[model samples]
Target chain A: EPEVTQTPSHQVTQMGQEVILRCVPISNHLYFYWYRQILGQKVEFLVSFYNNEISEKSEIFDDQFSVERPDGSNFTLKIRSTKLEDSAMYFCASSVKGAITEAFFGQGTRLTVV
Target chain B: AQTVTQSQPEMSVQEAETVTLSCTYDTSESNYYLFWYKQPPSRQMILVIRQEAYKQQNATENRFSVNFQKAAKSFSLKISDSQLGDTAMYFCAFMKVMNYGGSQGNLIFGKGTKLSVKP
Candidate 1:
């Protein structure tokens, strides 16, 4: 079965530095999302993307966070100046439709900011 | 705001035994979707089963089934004839059926329940 694929299974970055997490959603999927889970915490929604633009974002997705679908296949999340609290597992998901359809999730990218 | 709660933090069942994982959610919307996802040590989130609120009948897939009590706000997963491969962290999630521009597709996930199937 086709699945969402994320790059760089794990990443380590210095505080105040930038990091980019990439995802390639299923080819036919029309909706994409980004969610994060702090160690020992519930997964939290970050943002949703459709039509190459942001659809909705949470408080955690502040100015420092940005998402882009630079190409037909690549979706990326960029964090400018990472904070220690930013350490968590970031997941990318996609679906053929919106909330009504089941969203498939990727293995997740573990982001560690020291 | 919506919240999903998985009361059982950890549960273990012997191979070939049946196990049920409990999940309760708080939602005001009558039309919504409930999902159960399994995440193994690989950390890959895999969809186990899904139930739509409007459906009165329970949803089942092979050995996996769900008892969705919309009135009680309870959606529990039941694994029958469980095997060692069933060991994993299961998450209960909620999604509201709305067309609020682009925000309609977000999912609210619970803390998850860790299940251990001992052979």
Candidate 2:
């Protein structure tokens, strides 16, 4: 079955440096999302993208965070300056339809900021 | 806003026994979707099952089934004849249907319940 695919299974970056996480959603999917889970914490929603623009975002998705669909197939999330608290597992997901359709998740990218 | 709650933080079951994980949600929207996702030690999120709020007939996938009570706002997952492979952290999530401009599909997830199956 087709699934969401994320690049760089694991990444370690400096506290003040920038990092980019990339995802390639299923070809036919229309909706995409980004979520993160801190160690021993609940998975928190970051943002959702559709039609090549941000559809919605959470408080956790502040100015430092940005998402782009540079190419038709590639969706990327960029963090301007990483912090120690930013360390977590970031997941990329997509659904064929909107809310009612079941979303499929990628095998997360583990981001470690030191 | 919609919220999903998984009261059980951890649970254990014998290899051949049955286990149930509890989940409750708060949502005013009559049309929505509920899902059960499994994350094993590998930390890969896998969709185990899903149920539509409007469907009265509980959804079942082999040994896995759900008891969805629309009136009580409850959706629970039951695993029968559990196997060691079933050991994982299970999360219950809720999604509200929205078509408003600039606001669309997003999932509100619970804290998750860690389940360990003893051999």
- Whose TM-score is greatest here? 1
The true-structure Cα RMSD of candidate 2 reads 1.8
Please report, in order, the local distance difference test score of every candidate based on alpha carbons.
Answer: 0.92, 0.91
For model 1, the superposed segments whose C-alpha errors exceed 4 Å read: B99-103
lDDT of 1 by residue, A20-43 (tens): 999999999999999999998888
Every model: Cα RMSD to truth:
1.5, 1.8
- What is the lDDT for A53 in model 1? 85
DockQ of each: 0.67, 0.62
Model 2: lDDT of residue B27:
92
User: What TM-score against the true fold does each predicted structure earn?
Assistant: 0.97, 0.95
- By summed lDDT, the worst window of 10 consecutive residues in model 1 chain B runs over B97-106
For candidate 2, write residues B15-56 as lDDT tens digits: 999999999999999888888999999887998999988789
Give the CA lDDT, 0 to 100, for residue A34 in model 2: 95
Which runs in model 2 stand beyond 4 Å of their true positions?
B99-103
Interface RMSD of each: 2.0, 2.4
